[model samples]
Target chain A: MKEKIHIIKIGGSLIDDTELLDQFLDQFSGIKGKKILVHGGGKLATTLADKLGIEQKMVNGRRITDKDTLDIVSMVYAGSINKNIVAKLQQKKCKAIGFSGADANLIKAKKREHAEIDFGFVGDIEKKSINKKLISKLMKLELVPVFSAITHDKKGNLFNTNADTIASVIAQALSAKYDVELLYCFDKEGVLEDVDNPQSLIKTISEEEFSNLKNEGKLHKGILPKLENALSAVKNNVNKVFLIKETQLKNHIENHHEGTEIC
Target chain B: MKEKIHIIKIGGSLIDDTELLDQFLDQFSGIKGKKILVHGGGKLATTLADKLGIEQKMVNGRRITDKDTLDIVSMVYAGSINKNIVAKLQQKKCKAIGFSGADANLIKAKKREHAEIDFGFVGDIEKKSINKKLISKLMKLELVPVFSAITHDKKGNLFNTNADTIASVIAQALSAKYDVELLYCFDKEGVLEDVDNPQSLIKTISEEEFSNLKNEGKLHKGILPKLENALSAVKNNVNKVFLIKETQLKNHIENHHEGTEIC
Candidate 1:
C-alpha cells in the first residue's frame, strides 16, 4: 500500500470562517492515511497581544517576538487556536489532538540569537529529537495531530517559530511518500503579479520567478513569507505548496485548483 | 512603604463564563500594586481531550497527565486560558503577559515518579531555578503576569503542575508582605460542613478542624486537594487562603468577607 500523508497549513484568516474550516476538515476526513495540520495564528495572536497591552513589533513582515510577545503568541497559537480547531474537528466527528513543540520533545529547537538583531525567542529545530514513535502511536488511533508553531530549547525555554517552517519540518520528518500540500489560505485568490488587479493571479511560479516578483515589489509583504515558506517546503521534499484563498478551500482540495502551485 | 503583591486564582468555571470573566476584569482594574494570576482549565482540557478521542482519567482529583494529555493540558492551560485572561486584562487597560514554566526557565521541576503510582509528565518544583528576575522585570514595566500551571523538567520536558501549588511557590519565592490568598472559586458558595445543606457553609476552620471534617467523610473528594493546597500555601508563608464563590470576588478582595477563610 502506498502510504498517503497530507500536510495542510491553515492560515489565521481561515480560522474565523468556521464554515470554511469545517468544509476543509470534511474534505480532509475523506482522505486515507495520516493528515497533519499546521496552523498559523498571527492575526489572532496579535489581537490577543494588543488586548493584553503587549507591544508587538515586526521586522520584514516577521513578528519580532520579544519575551512578552512570545508569551502571548504561545498562548494563542498552542492554546486557543490549537484547541478550538480540535474542538471544531471533533464537533464535525473527526478525532483531533492539539500539540505544542514541548510535548514528547516532538519538536526540539535550538536558540537562534541573531547577533545583529535581537530575535528574543526564536528557534531552529534540532532534527534528532523529533519523535516519530509518538506521532505513529497517535496516527494508529486515527487521530489527527494539530500543531502550533512553537518550539522549546534543550534548557526548557519556549520559542516562537514560523508556522510555515514548522509545517514543512513535520511533513519532511513524517516522510509518508505523498506530496505535502501546504495551503497558505489568505483573503485573496492567489499570488498576484499586479497587486491592484484580481485577474493577475499567478497560477504557477518557479523559485527564481517568485524571488524576482519579490524584488520588483509586486508581491505584498504578507504574501512574501508564505511564498518563501512554500518554496522551502518544496526544497525540503514537500511535493507541492498552494497559496489559495480561504473561500476556495474545498475547490482547491477536491480539484487542486483556485490557487498558485509551487513545486 | 512595605512591598505589596496580590496572588489571585481565577477558577476555570469563571473563565467558562465570558460575561462573568469580563465583570471580574472590570473589578480587577481597581486593584493596586503587583498582581499574579494562577489559572486552571481542567474542564476545557477534558473537553478537548474527549473531542480528540483521548480518554480522560483522574487520580485523587489530579488529571493523570500522560505525554499526550500533557500536550493537550499545556495547550488549554498555558496557551488558551492564559492568553484569554491576558487579553481580557489588556482590554481593561491593564498590562498583562502570559507565561508557563518553560519561558526563561521560570519554574524548574523534577519528575515525581513514585513507586506505587507514576504521575506521568508531573513535576515537583525545584526552587532554585524560579526566575524571579523575569517577574521583577515585568513588574517594573507594570505588566501583570498571567501564569499557567505547566512546568518543565531540568532537561526541558514540559510537565503538568498544579496551579494552586504554583501559586503557593510563587508567593513564597517573592516573599511579598501582602497577604497571599488562593481563591478556590467554584460553582458552590463555599466549603460546607454538611454536603447536603446549602446553609452549612463553614465560615471559618483551623487546619486541624478541616482535617477532622475530611476524616469524617464530610469534606468530599473535590475539595480535598483544594484544602491541601490552601493549607500548604498558608504553611509556606502565604498569609491566608479563601474558598469562595466566583460572584463574590470584589467583596472578598475589598472586605475579606463572604467566604470560608482557612488558616
Candidate 2:
C-alpha cells in the first residue's frame, strides 16, 4: 500500500477571512500524515489592483491576466499570502514551506493558447507539468509545501494559473506514489441541489451524475470549473477526490466523509 | 577538504536595473559548483509604496518597518523581485529555487528590540538562526536557492530583515560544512578610500583598518553595516569575504580577486 497524502485546496473566501483561515490552519497542522495546501488568490489581489488603479482586463468574458495584474497577483499570491500562511503554519508546529511554481521549476506551464482570445499571462498545465520527483524528495524531508497559484514557463515567464487545476494536476501526478486524496475546501458545504439551500448537499457525485446535473442546468456557474477539475482528478487515478467545506477539514479527516465526494 | 560554496548577495540598485540585472544573472549562472544568491529589494518596494500612498516612517534617522511597510516589502522583496530573479536564472539553465526565511522555517528571527524606538516588523538574526542542515540537503539536490530578505519570527509574524546580514549569517552558519565564500555585490567598485573615485578602491581591509577608517570618519554611512557584516562572517570563520561590483562577479571568480577582500 502506498503512503497516503492529502492535497487540500482552499479557495478565496476562506483565504480572505483571517479568523476562519486561522481556525482552518490550526486543524490542518494537526493532520497525522503528509499534506500539501494549495491556495487561491483572494480579494487581496483585486483589492491591491484597485488601490493601484490597474484596470481589470477581460476578453470574451474571461478575466485576462495582463502584465500589471500578473505582477500584483504574483506579489499577493506567491509572496504575501503564501509567506504569511507558511509562517502561521510554522507557528502551529507544521513544517510548512511556501512556493510559487517558479521555485525549483516545480511546475512548468504552457501559455494558454486560444484561437480567438489572448489570455495575456495565463498558464495552463497538465499532470506532466508537475515536477513530482523533486516534490516527493522535498516531502521526504518532512516539509509541507504550500503552493500559490502561480506557475512559470521554463523560458523565463511567470503566469497566473488556476489553483483548482494546479491541485488536480498535482494530485494526478503524485497518484503513482501516494494514495492521494484531493480535497477542494470552499465556503459552501458541498455541491447543493439548490443554490440557496444548505441542506441540499450531495453526498457523492459521479461524473455521469455531474453531467446529468449540468444538462439539467442545476449546477451553479461558479462550480463548473471546480467540478471539472475534480472529475479530471478522479479520472486520472487519484484515489479519492472531494469538495468540502473549509470548516469540516478536521471532521472529514477523522470521520472519512464530509461534503461531496467525486468519483 | 570541504566543498567550496559561493554565497553571493546582490543589493537593491542592481536589482532595480533590468539590463544590468540580466547581465549579472548571466554571469551568475556561469558560476561553477554549489552556490546561493541572496537579494535585496530594489526601488520597486518604495515605488509600490509611493503609488499606494503609504507614508515612510522613520525614528531617529532609522527607517521603521511598520505593518503596511512590512506588507509592501514582503510582497516586493520575497514575491516580485525574488521570483523574477529565480525565473530569469532558470531561463539561464540554473536550477534556482526562491525563498523567504519563513519557508521551511529556514531563518527564524526575533523582532528587533530597541530601547526607546519600536521597530515594528523588523527582525534581527544571528549565525544560529539559519537552518543549515536542511539548506545542505537542498543544495545536495542541486537546486540553487535564491533568497529574498524577508524573515519570520516563527511565532507567525513576517519581518523585514537586512539582506546583507542574512547573507553574512548564512555564510557563517554553512561554513562548518562548506568552504564558504561570501560576496556582497553592489554598484560600487569596492570600498573606496575616496567615495567619489572608483580608482581609490582598497584592495583589502583588516578589521583594525576598518575601525581606523570609521574613527577617521572616512567610511560612508551606507557601507558601514555591510562592512560590519563582512567582518562578522570573517570572524565566524567564513572562508572568504569580499565587496565587489555586481558586474565583476565572473571576473572575480575567475581571477580569484577583483574587489576589497575583508580580512
lDDT of 1 by residue, A1-263 (tens): 44666777777667767677777767665656677888887576676556556787877655577987876677668775665566555545555656666653567677786756667788876335456666666566566778878776545467788787787677666655444566676778788887777799999988889878878888887787778777876777766678887667667777867778886
Q: Between which residue pairs do clashes occur in model 2?
A: none
Measured against the true structure, the TM-scores of the candidates, in listed sequence, are: 0.55, 0.99
Q: What is the DockQ of candidate 1?
A: 0.08
For residues A209-249, could you state the per-residue lDDT of candidate 2 as single tens digits?
99999999999999999999999999999999999999999
lDDT value, candidate 1, whole model: 0.71
State in Å the error of residue B12, model 2: 1.0
- Every candidate's DockQ is 0.08, 0.91
Off by over 4 Å in 1: A1-76, A80-263, B57-63, B126-129, B176-179
The reply for model 2, stretches above 4 Å from the true place, is none
- Model 2, B178-213: lDDT tens digits are 999999999999999999999999999999999999
Chain A TM-score of model 1 versus the true structure?
0.87
